[model samples]
Target chain A: MVIVSVAMLILFCMIYLIPGDPAAVALGPRATDAMREGLRIKMGLDKPVWVQFWNFFFAAWQGDLGRDVLSDRLVATVVMEQLPYTLALIFGGISWSVALGIPLGCWAAVERGTMADRIVGVLSVAVIAVPSFVVAIYALLIFAVALRWLPAIGAGEPGDIGDQLVHLILPSLAVGLGWVGYIARMVRASMLEVLESQHIRTARAFGLPERMITYRYALTIAILPTVTLLGVGIGQMLSSAVFAEIVFARPGVGKLVYDAILTRNYPLVTGAVLVTTILFVLLNLLADLIVGALDPRVRSRL
Target chain B: MTVLSIKDLNVTFSTEGGRLHALKDVSFDVPERRIVGVVGESGCGKSTLINAILGLLADNGRVDAGSITFEGEDLTRLGPARMQELRGQRISTVFQDPMGALNPVLSVGRQMRNIQYRSGRSRSEKDARSEAMLRQVRIPDAQAALARYPHEFSGGMRQRVAIAMALMMRPALLIADEPTTALDATLEVATIELLRELQQDIACSVLFISHHLGVIAELCDDVVVMYAGEVVERGTTRQVFHTPRHPYARRLLECDPARQSGRTRHLPTIPGEIPDLRQRPPGCVFATRCDQRVDACDKVPPDVAVETGHVARCVLAEAR
Candidate 1:
């Protein structure tokens, strides 16, 4: 809650500092001076910056993020409509990354210094080195343009779950591919460390099968850092999702903010950023809670 | 009858320098229901010997030659599956640091149940067995203790839990690798007593390894002294302690703080380090450090039998 309020304040300040009058942007170049002045007063832009901030902050605290200048609709309603798409994309990216990353990490660790391990090592580094936007562009060109197997643009028909999921495949892949590298490397390093621990040796000494020792005994502890990484990864994915959303032409909170920023839609941009920050903070809290549950030493302190 | 016999075990580790002969011609036995202690300094290959017997040597280390024969089977030749099957069922181990040996994320009951993975018993029955073993180790409120994690207990109690888990299956042989070295003086004695009591109750042969000569004298029936990967001396605890034949074994005993009669500013210590294993000396391993070294000591010393069962690798063993 504290983080959300602070984020709102900072967003408001930054948007205010940006050189462009929202009134002029809304009115266009042919408007007379009288008309621009009238529009500025109506949009609450005539007040001092501090008063403008107070008004915006108070209204936002009461669940009102002011009205969009061009559309004349509530910013909160606009954000609510677009949030679900962005959330789905972020979650899909995270889900697939975890699905692919963990097993690859465990396999590489189990086969520590072999050809398979070397291949995974090289591939993970390659993916991480290439930015997500570059991946998004290349993926768009290959899958959508050249291969026309999937849809090229839009988030599909609004109410059709199957079409939206199909459209989601490419964007989520672009957003999540790099994270797969991050997660796999993290899991591999921690797994190797845990494998060297005395408890693992003791487990082997007691005659547990190699499979049980690797997956059950070692992985349970090794996956802790990866869980924490997932929380932070979601925040990073949100920024990457903007590129994915724009490249794929999907209607999401990130694309909404991107369009609003171009049109000087301060209310919409501030509201969307504040909401995403809140969600990120909550997701990190969830990660910490999961770690506490998994490790008893952490649980006792909690 | 021998519960476990290691015959001419030769193990080496490949390093950037060269292949380190970690254990060379090392051999010993744990007779039925007897406690055999291997005493040596830090780099004397005690751990390498244990790893060899358990087939748990590091990736760089390999058994160059040897056979660890237990019962009617050779452990060196056993496949991973068979070796795993024999581990907790036929042979278990208690490690030096109890906290490091038990998983911190798991409960005592969960780990105890896991150790009995081969039992093919139901969860409730396994829980019952775990409680029984904890009770045998004299852990207070053994039932409640099972639900607790390893860090929840004090150091001594955790060691007790490790012992309980190790002995739950009534293994034919138990390897205790410096199990008491991590505890304080009082806790060390208590842990040793608990281990002794548990061994007698379970009627299992124990292969104990430690540098504490007094602990060996108090607990073991026989002792083997290792120097630079070789078994320098072997005899009954009485014969070896009362009449040490090998110069290294004799020097090791003299350095024991418990054996000193008067207060002195300087503690007795063997003057030289163990020989570098990367290039094994052609002569006796202890010759450079031996105070009574003669011209003949420059060659490989013969294994001289000073008595019926007592043996020492030294030129002067027969004379001494």
Candidate 2:
């Protein structure tokens, strides 16, 4: 909770400190100097920085993020309108990463020092080395330009479920690319360490079947650290969504925040940042709970 | 009748440096319903022997030569599935560190129930059996312990839980790998006593491995003294302790601090460190430290009969 407050405070200061005038942007170059001054006071931009922060702090608590300077709409409403699309894209990305990453990691650990292990090691490294945006561009070219299997740009129309899903495919793949390498590597390392633990040897000595030994015994312990990684992976997806949304022309918080900053939309920028930070915090808390549930030693500590 | 017999066993471990011969021409037997103790210092192949017999040798280890026969079947030739079936059913192990032996994540009852999967019993029946086994090992609130995780138990209590789990299936042979080494002195003695009483009640043979000579002398009917991957002496506990024939065995007995009388300036110690397995001596593995070494000690000493059912691998014993 403290983290969220601190993050918002930092973001608020950085956004205002930038060389941009919200009142000037709202009134445009044609407006007279007296008109700009009047608008600055009306929007509270003429207030002291501390007073402005205090007002934002109180208003945010009540979910009143003020109005966007350009659109003159409530910033919260603007963010809420685009929230579902960003969330859907992130959900699909996380699901894809876990579904592919876990089995590949298990297979690599089980076949350590074998050809399969080497292939997985090399491929994951290559994937991590290439940035997510590069993967996005390649995905756009191959799937959209050449094969024409899916839409190339923009979020689908409202209330059209099939079109929304079709538009989500390329962007989700781009966001998921970064997570696949990170999660797979973590799972493989964790599995190898767990496999060598003495309790695993004890389980083997007890004559449990190979399946039980690997999945039931080793996997349970191995998956704990990976759970934490997946939490961090969600935050990565959020940041990556900024670029992904821009490339695909999707209606999302990422695009809203980017355009808000470019046009000096202070309320919109702060609202978007606050929502993303809270989501990240919640995801991490869930990860900790899952970890505590999986491991008795940690659970007792908690 | 012998319940388990190992003949001419040889185990080697391949490592980054080279192959290390861990065991050489070792042979012993556990008579039906009898306890046999294997005594040695650290790195004397005690764990290697146990792992080889259990078919749990590490990835780099191999049973290069030998046959481990239990009851009537050869374990080395058995397939993995058959070996797994035999394991925990006919041959169970109680490891030294109880905290490491039991999975901390699993409840005590759940871990015990896993072993009963092949018994074809229902979950509640397995739970009842686990409680009964815990009670057999003298754990307090046996029923409540079933719901607790392994970490909640104290060290001695965990060892008892381990013992209960090992004996749950009524295995024919129990291999205890210094199961009491990690406990306090009082707990150590109590755990050992519990082990003996329970072993008798179950009527199963035991192969006890420990580096502590006192533990071997107290519990073993037959004792095998191992030095540098080789069995230097084998005889009944009484025969070996009273009249040790091998020079190393004689020195080992002298090194026991309990045997020293009051006001001794220094307790006895064998002169040198145990030779590394990578550089085993040309003949007698203990010859480098033996006080009675002769020129012929450079050659492999044959097993010479020192008494009925007693043997010592030494040139001096051969001369006698």
Candidate 3:
């Protein structure tokens, strides 16, 4: 909750720090000076910064995030409109990362010092070193330009779930690629450590099959640390979606925030920031809950 | 009648500094249904001996010589897959730290069930067997304890739970690596006694490893005394305790505070550090700290027979 307040505080201050005339932007440069002044007064842009902030802060508690001066739409409406696209992108990204990362991590750890382990280690390091947007460019060149398998830009038919999924593929990859490398490396390191633990040695002594020991004993323990990384990945994924959405010309919460920031749309930007903060908090909470559920020792500690 | 036999076994670890001779030409046997204790101070390679038999040696540890035969199979030659089949079914192990031995993520019942997967019994039957084993280990409210995690149990209870899990399959031989070292004194005695009773009840041989001589004396039928990665003495517990032939063994017995007869201000301690495995001296490893060291101690010591089955590796033990 305090984080939410801080986010609001930062977002509220961003408008003043940025050099822009919202009234002139809304009325257009060609508008008469008297008309621009009239619009500024009507939109309460002439009010003191603290008074404007105070009004928005109190109204935000009641779910009123104010209206977009340009679109004349409610800030809440714009957020809700673009929220699903952002969420879907984040979900797609996380799924792809986890799907690829975990098994690769287990394989790398089990094959440590082997050719396969080295290859995976190298590939993961490479992916981690390269920025996601750079990877996004290559993905676009291959999948969109060369292969012609996917759309190059803009989200597909808005209400069509299949088109939306198709449109999200490249964007998700753009966001998820780095996370895959991160999660895979974390799982490998964690699995190696867990494999050396006494409990795992005990499990092996129990005459369990090699597969069972690897998956049941080692993987279960190893995956705990990875879950926390995934929680942090959520915030990274959300931010990455801003760039992905911009590159792909898809409108998401990130894209909405990006455009709002560019145009100095205070209400829309503030609303988006608050939502992202809440999502981040919720993701961390979910991670803690999962860890507690997985390990009774941690659960009792909690 | 040997349930587990290790003959001329040598294990070496290739560490960064040098080759560490962890176990040297070690030989021992756990007769059917008998508890043979392997007693030594820390770094004596007692745990390494157990790991060698169980094929749980660390990555760097290499069994350079000899064979470990369980029942009839040569364990050292067996592949990991085949050895795993024999492990827990024919040769289970109870580790030193019960808390560290059991998976923290799993419930006591779940882990027990995992071990019983090969039993091919129904889930309910496995549960019933688990409860029965817990009761056998004398855990009160065995059924309730099943749902509990390892951390929920007291240290003593955890050891019992570990014992119950280990003995559930009734392996032909059970290697207990200081299972009671972590417990308090009262718990230690009770756990040792319980382990003895359970061993008999299951009719399984136990190669019990511990540094605690008192526990070994009370629990073992036979004992092998080790020093610096080599067994210096081997005999029945009565024979070895009543007449420890090796200088190191005698000093070890003397160091036991329980054996003190009179009010002594300072307890007796063996002089000198345990010879480093990497730089073991010529002659006997214990000769440097031997109380009665002579010029003859510079030569390799011979294994001398004290009685029919009793043996000690010492120059003094050898008759002229």
Model 3: pairs clashing at backbone N, Cα or C within 3 Å: none
Residues A1-302, candidate 1: write the lDDT tens digits: 88878887888889888999888888888999999999889878899988999998899889898788789899889999999999999988998789989998989999999999999899899989989999999988999999998887788898999999999888999999998888889999999999999999999999998888898899999999999999888899999999999999899999999999999887788888888888899899999999999999999998
**lDDT measured at residue B64 in model 3 versus the true structure, 0 to 100:** 97
Model 3 residue A240 lDDT score: 86
Q: Is the docking of candidate 1 incorrect, acceptable, medium or high quality?
A: high
Please list the C-alpha lDDT of all candidates, in the order they appear: 0.91, 0.89, 0.89
* Chain B TM-score for all candidates, comma-separated: 0.98, 0.97, 0.97
Clashing pairs in 1: none
- Please list all clashing residue pairs in model 2, or write none if there are none: none
DockQ of 2: 0.75
Q: Write the per-residue lDDT of candidate 2 for residues B244-319, one digit (tens) a residue.
A: 9999889989899888888798888888998878767789999889899899999999888888878898989853
RMSD of each: 1.7, 1.7, 1.7
Write down the worst ten-residue block by lDDT for model 3 chain B: B311-320
Which lDDT tens digits does candidate 3 get at residues A7-29? Answer: 77887787668888877777777
